[model samples]
Target chain A: EDQVTQSPEALRLQEGESSSLNCSYTVSGLRGLFWYRQDPGKGPEFLFTLYSAGEEKEKERLKATLTKKESFLHITAPKPEDSATYLCAVQAGGSGTYKYIFGTGTRLKVLA
Target chain B: NAGVTQTPKFRILKIGQSMTLQCTQDMNHNYMYWYRQDPGMGLKLIYYSVGAGITDKGEVPNGYNVSRSTTEDFPLRLELAAPSQTSVYFCASRRGGTTDTQYFGPGTRLTVL
Candidate 1:
């Protein structure tokens, strides 16, 4: 069975605070890992995709890194606008399919 | 490119009633998917299609049906609505190949009574 778990279900940070969200998974095989940001009453917005271990991708103040068993989304000097639910998902190998197994997500609130 | 679009942003369905949620993307994406999210829970895959005329069940496909008659549109059908089916539905599409990013629609909020 495949499973994804995210840590720190909720986080509150000061405007300039920096932190990282973790996504650990157990899959038969790993194809890709994705990071997304979702606001209340809206759909998720794609952020980054990391394919292999030791790979990292970044966008603005957000950075995503992946290892064999886990992935991390690091936010540097976050702002109030960066407050949203961060989602982690994985695409496992086999079947050439893109069915994603998603984590429960970490809700982040940045106080200005 | 309008990315992905979903219609009827909100709906209220009575038990046993049926409804179809429409999703369309203009990016010429070859893969499309339907997902449902409940409060405080992660998104669950309902159905997906690799291309036109090809569809398959996902993790939570029990009360749902999907059709991918064209590369641009994928609609999810709820045959018999139930309270458990009340959720926020999202539509996403991805380009061909393995590394393309998946774009998502704004989502539809459904309430079943």
Candidate 2:
């Protein structure tokens, strides 16, 4: 079975504090890993996509790194505006289908 | 371009009532999907279509139906609404497969009574 597990269900950080969220997965072949940020009462916004192990991508204050078995979303000096639920998803190859298995997500709060 | 638009931002439905949630994208994406998000739960796929005339069930397909008669429109139908169906529904589109970044709508908040 292919599944994703995210840790630290919730986190609170002071403004300017940096942190990292973990997303681990168990799958046969990883085609891609996706990161999304979702605000309250809104749909998720696409963040980054890591295609292979040791791959990394960054946007503004967010950086995403991927490995064979796990992925990390590192927030650098986060601001209150960056507070939101972060979602991680994985797509496995050879499924002969197009579907993504998503993690439960980590709720992040940046207190000002 | 109205990337992906969903109708009825909020809706309240009584048990056993049926409704259709409309979704349309102007990006000419070949893939469209419907997902329901429960509190604290990740978005679960309800249905997806690769292109016109091709629809398939996803992770949670029961109580839902969909049609893709054109590249720009994909609507999700709920027959016999239930309290268990109360959730925020999101419609998304991508140029292709899961590897592609999906653009999502604002989402529709549905409450079942």
Provide interface RMSD per model, one decimal. Answer: 1.0, 1.7
True contacts kept of each: 0.75, 0.72
| Pairs of residues at least 3 apart in sequence or in different chains that clash in candidate 1 | none
- Candidate 1 residue-wise lDDT at A15: 98
Write one digit per residue (lDDT tens) for candidate 2, span A1-112: 9899998899999999999999999987888889999999999899999999999999999999998899999999999999899999887867445777889899999999
Question: For each candidate, how many residue pairs have backbone atoms clashing (under 3 Å)?
Answer: 0, 0
lDDT of 1 by residue, B21-86 (tens): 999999999999999999778999999999999999998999999988899999999999999999
lDDT per residue (tens digit) for residues A1-112 in model 1: 8999998899999999999999999987788899999999999998999999999998899999999999999999999999999999998867677678899999999999
* lDDT minimum window of 10 residues, candidate 1 chain B: B94-103
Supply the global lDDT for candidate 1.
0.93
